[model samples]
Target: MPDYNGSVDYLKKAALRGSRLGLERISELMERLDNPQNRVKTIHVAGTNGKGSFGAMLTSILTEAGYTVGGFSSPALTGITDSFRINCREITKKDFAEVMTEIIPHCEAMEDKPTEFEVLTAAAYLLFFRKGCNISVVECGMGGDTDSTNVLCFPLLSVITNVQKDHTAFLGETIEEIARHKAGIIKCSRPVIYGGTDLTVSDLILREAKKKCSEFYSTDYFRVSDTSSDLSGTEFSFDGMGDFRMQLLGKYQVMNAATVLTAVEVLRGQRINIPDEAVRRGLEKARWHGRFEVVRREPYVIYDGAHNPDGIRSAAESIELYFRGSDIVLLIGVMADKEYGLYTDMLGSRIRKAFTVTPDNPRALASDKLAEVFRAADIDAEPFDDLAKGVCSAYEYAKANGLPLIALGSLYMYGDFMDALNNITE
Candidate 1:
């Protein structure tokens, strides 16, 4: 808990303390930051998947409409700690250092030192408020009810992207329980946008929204058509709205875009004046780092941080759709908390060969453990010492074998993979 003044080492030092899930520490820290979250209008987004990309899309459109946008995303696509961004740029090291300096003593003065996530959340809002952004798009770090970001009152909109079964240990095991946690973001009277396909989960959300009398807009209620995905982006047609395009690929984004558009329409009805041009521009510019990100050309290296089974299945489907008929070699690493058998079962049946490695996080599942899971499934999983060596070996194997390759499993692997990939390119 040292002062964070303008040191490039702020993250390295702060990151050392590591992640501990829970929001009481963050709630306390934010109170010391003058609760900047309340000063700005916010669009609170939470779901099992696609919420991050949806948040990116929301920020993009809000920015295009000339709003100074503040964004806070978790598990930063890269390892840069405190991926708090302002006006669409990652908070610079100097800014991070300065803000940490400002908030540290306040955090220390509190009952206890703030947890990393709490400090980061407080820093994001304080920095955004200081930078003078009109609105912020905040993605929940974990569940919604007690989530640190949930402190925002009167968020312009609460977006529940999609609820799926992940984080069963902390959140809940049943879909209803998971939905309840996500639906907790719905303010008493604020507009709530629901954008996912699971009926059981969607039903839980709708039930909550009705109980609160919050207006709900769902993709199932919208008339969407002519959706297409290519490497460039996705092109789609809407019912009330005509043609719209987004830089993000896959059919799933069409629903995500619909959710964004639905929120925009609600905002417009409330006299927000978000022009169609802004909406189009926002969809075009939305850039989330790791979801089905194509990292290389020539041999077509792709990266997807699909740690859970639902995510892995979705990524696999996207692969079959986008890179159909191409033989695939997968490079994988995952955390210990996830359901390994389910995840591997969903992905193993799709790819030709698989390679396993453990991520750098202490919570990571050992490579041998992952190998055993795949092997039991009759998959020939080659275990590597670590992510770096695994990725290198996989890349070489793919090169020698002349097949398309995919690197996935956990977002924790992204920083190392991205760093390694960059080094290779350089």
Candidate 2:
């Protein structure tokens, strides 16, 4: 039997084969596995941002409603195994290794080898089927149409959360093009709930739903009112569902919760039987780590994986809303292909000092290059190749100057930041 570390290493090697986005390899692979994805009811989620959080919330709601739920999300926050969850708990290492061992032989036999994501997606489906999940929430790996998880033929419902400009290289260069890709998840006659406020993008999605004969619902269906947030959590009331609170912070979360609520309404219409009390408790209990997550208090350190322009803007807005009138000491690390300059421009005025570090990935932007971008924006900036050194510098500076520290940029840097915080606090 393959050990946990060995199994993970094998998956990592498959990842080196790179992202081959298409349904053919995944379709063939799932066919060999007898298409377990079809055996279970699924709520397929797709968008540039908010897919993970939305899926997490939906999973929480279903779990609280007394249903066994399986969740699959991409670009694991902690480890590869974090991407697959049963009842909101990550898959155990032993189980992950055992499942990989079972899947590896079939993967090796494929005429065209599946990508790491494809393998993982297949594993999640099989696990969900074997475990008898009442339902599953599957977040798309990338653009919806051709994403590995799109192999689901008839999802119980399709969710498209707020389209934005990211992954332009593969999805498209424009918002309309990206929306088309996102809308690809809409299956014929299935209900789709979209949370995006962009008129152009929303219209495209509506059109796609019409073309596919899918029922379409929008955020307009539910209004989020009396929204409030602090370091603890966010509080908001949705139409008919009053006074809901969530551990997930930011106004963006209110919008995401609205999407989840809208989805619940549709599910109820389909005879899912989710209770109102379950919805309230689920929102309050759902936790999505590394998004405006506060790690420390004295020096006030926050870590947010806001790598894109729109995401960074939302992070900046949340910062201003939460810590208004306080200057932020920013620690940033990002990928080479991200819109780092735009990120700086969006939050530059609010930042008092900046420390840049390279994220732990081959595609990470060089620390010095990131520093140069910040410097050109006229913010005091320094670069460090070593993430530990960068964290130390940012921490000490924030402590000495009495300013809050915020770490932003790539999700890949989250582990490094957490390690740094652990070292400092210990």
Candidate 3:
């Protein structure tokens, strides 16, 4: 293949490189490139859910501490060319093109070409190193053990946000087995900060972390803030961090905040010197879009990409707590791989009018199928063929009837909703 050095061209080449879901190719590629991951401190994260949100919070806090932080997040929330980012922005198109040009020859030199994720990760490691970041926060794209991002053997710390059942085709069937995959991000010598969850699956993660010689810190060690969820934002106070505020909504975010705070304490022991003020500031400034993100007001519009049972439960709680008695109209779309009935059953009870549609992905479940799930639960659900049409129908229903509408389900349709709202982030 030609050495493509433009953003669009590079992405085309990247697409042509098929998926190889193993770390061996990435290990060899990074090794040949002088292991740039070793040149800087890193906070590696892995989990079935909340990895993106937690990573965003950690990046914000670390940046507030006056550190130049580079981050590599999977399934990009924005940008098309690269899966890597620096200071919350995607790597520049020119930089991505240049890296692709350099990486092509190296791939050709190998006995076999590197997979798409592996090549992108290699480029990111080099980019972050060259950018002079004090640290990098990396989120594993899949499970940790065989994930390409696991190449870093001695990160400054490892974080497993919260493991649940997802990616069963690769990770495993049960929660304990899934936790093992997520816990693979932990290294023997590094410290691990884990979010507190009530699952025995969480216990498995703790056990694995201890077995690996990690200094594991759990939320049980800290006093969690009781946060109130509202459209304006979430508010809570802790013993040490004092009264903290966040623009992010949801009670689950309060748990994420606790995890971030615990991590700050762990980093402080290594003399990172992140003050309590920084923690509060970081929580306020951290933005992870599409998690109960409010896109419009005056007959409000809320967008949440709750794709699983746990995520749906959290979304349901946030809506009940904040938007109670507001006539909760819902615009829903979901993926084929998810347990649609479970999510719909949980969310159906709260929805005043539920409009179901398929997202942009080929893997999207049919809207009729989703509507059937809602109807099975005795919800008055309607089906729309397209996302834009469904959104319009929901908006019209809300506008005519004077109710607030929530557009949610799969993240695949989130971009569509955001675009329809003139591309605003929450």
Candidate 4:
């Protein structure tokens, strides 16, 4: 009875239905618009984490090679427009509103309504083709097989960054099940590049690629040598790709960069003309905001979005390596489905204290419960009922003790945490 408008408010309403992973709704929605996904060339990226950073790296290098690259990643980090990018620039609010306006009616009219991610995927497809992109790198929202983005007709290639235990309720209960879900993107006999370290996952992906009669490339043999990592980000040489540096921190990021290079090699094999210089320049310029991003100095603070145990382990490795003996405090929040035990076990010994707050999401773990997780690991923990107070208190404690504070977990928390952190007095 009510009509949706061009305003972002309508998109917010669509998102409230939450995540229901499937391809059927998106398939029908694409049919309504004559299927824009089939008109464009795309590279599909899927993983539990680091996939966004990998996409960003690939986008930068491709842009350096003189292509108009469209990007679609999830969670919208700071704003609704953060999910969509063309040639490394975000789609303007005006353009985003206009595009969604055209697509909203079809979504509203669908008998089986599409989820927000499905609508976003369709919008990205339409935007990529309509905007005249040479090629676009699209990241999956969650598990690969049933993810709405899998509706792609035929992509240049499929990249599976890594498979870890995450979104278990939706994906499945085991790593094998999860790997099967991620391997779903291999289609149309397109080549696949597997970047995961897990042998089982890689073998599973290899089987899927074989089933599709597709070529498969793995990052397993790539040697990273003469490496150095600190607060300035990682610098290393990868198996003849030459020396490279990425502004994004952590050693895992170095591996992620190497994976991008592996993909670039595959692209070059397909007659794409990405030069060695583009790879070097792009890695130096690639910036994926909020993953181990340092937002302030003096009493230092970082904003990281390490939500799962595996991701947290990677982040923890980088943090420990960079600030081995320094005084550190943690400001954390997490989702309801996450197993927080490993988070505490790995990070507890390094933190002076932890201040916990609930993220502003429907599935966020309560602040008190998160604090309980930390305390069970012998971490000194404080719980806050209000996000701002928690941030201010954490800031004050870190400042008083001359410690660096890390605000970690849930991508949902970064927007709110940064807003609160900005208001604190230095």
Superposing all C-alpha atoms, what RMSD in Å does each candidate have to the true structure? 2.5, 1.2, 2.8, 1.9
Two-way TM-score contest, 1 vs 4, winner: 4
The candidate that wins on TM-score is: 2
Can you give the TM-score per candidate against the true fold? 0.93, 0.98, 0.92, 0.97
What is the TM-score ranking, best to worst? 2, 4, 1, 3
Candidate 1, backbone clash total: 1
Residue pairs whose backbone atoms clash in candidate 4: none
In model 1, which regions exceed 4 Å deviation? 1-23
Global fold similarity of model 1 (TM-score):
0.93
* Model 2, residue pairs in steric clash: none
Per-residue C-alpha lDDT of model 1 across residues 1-426, encoded as one tens digit per residue: 333443335445556666666667877777767788899888899988887778888888888999899888888767454477776777776677666678767866876566666767887788888889898989998879878788887888899988888888889888888889889999988989888878887788888999998988776534788878887778888778678887776546677788878888888876787888888888888887888887786577888878887788888888888887777888888888888788666776666778898888888988988888888888778998667777877777778777778888888778888877666541
Assess the local accuracy of residue 117 in candidate 1 as a C-alpha lDDT between 0 and 100: 68
Residue by residue across 1-426, what tens digits does model 2's lDDT show? Answer: 658888888788898889989999999988988999999999999988888889989899999999999999978878888899999999898878887888888889988999999999999999899889999999998999999999999999999998998888898899999899989999999999888889888889889999999899987634778888998888887878678999997657788888899999999988998999999999889988788888898978998888899899889998998899999999999988887878777899889999999888999999999999888989899999999999999999999999999999888778878888789853
Give lDDT tens digits, candidate 3, residues 1-426. Answer: 323345355455665776667778888888888899889899998876787788888888888888888988766544554356677666776777776676667777889777767877888788888889999998888888889889998999998888777777888888888787778888987898778575686677778877988787876534755657678888777666578888987767887877887788889997897877777788889988778888788678888878888888888888888877666898988888887778766676677889999887767889999899888887888998867778877887887787888877877676677665563223
Model with the higher TM-score, candidate 2 or 3: 2
Total clashing residue pairs per candidate? Answer: 1, 0, 0, 0
Worst 10 residues of 3 by lDDT: 1-10
Cα lDDT listed for each candidate:
0.79, 0.89, 0.79, 0.88
Q: Which ten residues in a row have the lowest lDDT in candidate 4?
A: 1-10
The predicted structure with the larger TM-score, 3 or 4, is 4
Question: Against the true structure, candidate 1 has what lDDT?
Answer: 0.79
